[model samples]
Target: MSTSMAENATKKLTLKSGDDELFEVEETVALQSQTIKHMIDEQWLGDVIPLPNVTGKILSKVIEYCRRHAGAGAGSGDASTSKSEDELVLATTTSGDDLKAFDADFVKVDRCTLFDLILAAHYLNIRTLMDLTFQTAADMMKKLTVEEVRTMFNIENDFTKEEEEKIQQEHPSAFK
Candidate 1:
């Protein structure tokens, strides 16, 4: 093979989403994702693989998550250091509390963007993103009334006022 061709093969992979948006990521980093892993395993297509389900905006976020977690599996850094994650968990209330606070704060976003993140996370096979987004959704629901959920998700109220009353009468805790 030509030296120039070998150099090209060693270059970072470029991923294109369904919307024709692109992401250039190291092959090592891309392999951290199971979706990419499968494609690589099967020797599918070329260096520039396309993901129809993922959009550019969401794909970028997924890449960020994969990069953080790529080293995690290799026993690489803070995440895989000598101490178990739980070792410090019980020691410092403030440490754990700080992380919890960080998690909460990091998840602040509108419903639609949050959903888009979820979809991208799922497609990218990034567990942390999926878990965080799900937890964020649950937290949002916990803070809202039933009507608030309906309004937030833009769900139509199917029952008429009379039907609603009848159902409410049958199930006293319906709204709650």
Candidate 2:
């Protein structure tokens, strides 16, 4: 097909990586990102826009988040007005039990995937997702002991015994 025709015909995109892995996403969803929008505007993307920084797995998950939010008209700059997230919460207040269940389940993800979701949400500029992910992370920090936190993330304790004790004293509530 001619280049102009190809450009016009493309409403979806296949983002490929150097390893030849591909991710399929809608133009509207992909364009939630300013980076992707610029690529579309400049017609720099062919059938497959290469995203070498993103692995196929992470990109796939990101695409899932983007697609869902996009379909709900949650992304930025659409002509149609969206209910503010607070307004959405208010409207759903009558169904409080259901919302609580959904929120609980939404955060039930592996630690690595939780961080991945946080990064993806931030990159796509999805505020609700980021807030949820960050809150989950903070909850983990609050609940886990210092040793437990170190074990969970495989982080080494750098402090000497005396230093560790001093820190514990300084932040007495952290250990409790």
Best candidate (score: TM-score) = 1
Task: Itemize residue pairs with steric clashes in candidate 1.
Answer: none
Candidate lDDT scores, in order, read: 0.69, 0.66
Cα lDDT tens digits for candidate 2, 84-144: 3332333444254644565567668889888877776676566666777899999988988
**Per-residue alpha-carbon lDDT of model 1 for 1-176, expressed as tens digits?**
55644453344779999899989875656776778879879988786889899888778867765554443343435433322233223223334455456556656767887899888778878677789999888877888877899998899999899998888889876467
The runs of at least 3 residues in candidate 2 whose Cα sits more than 4 Å from the true structure, single-residue gaps closed, are 1-10, 17-19, 41-43, 74-78, 81-106, 121-128
Task: State the number of backbone clashes in model 1.
Answer: 0
Against the true structure, candidate 1 has what lDDT?
0.69
RMSD list, candidates in order: 7.7, 7.0
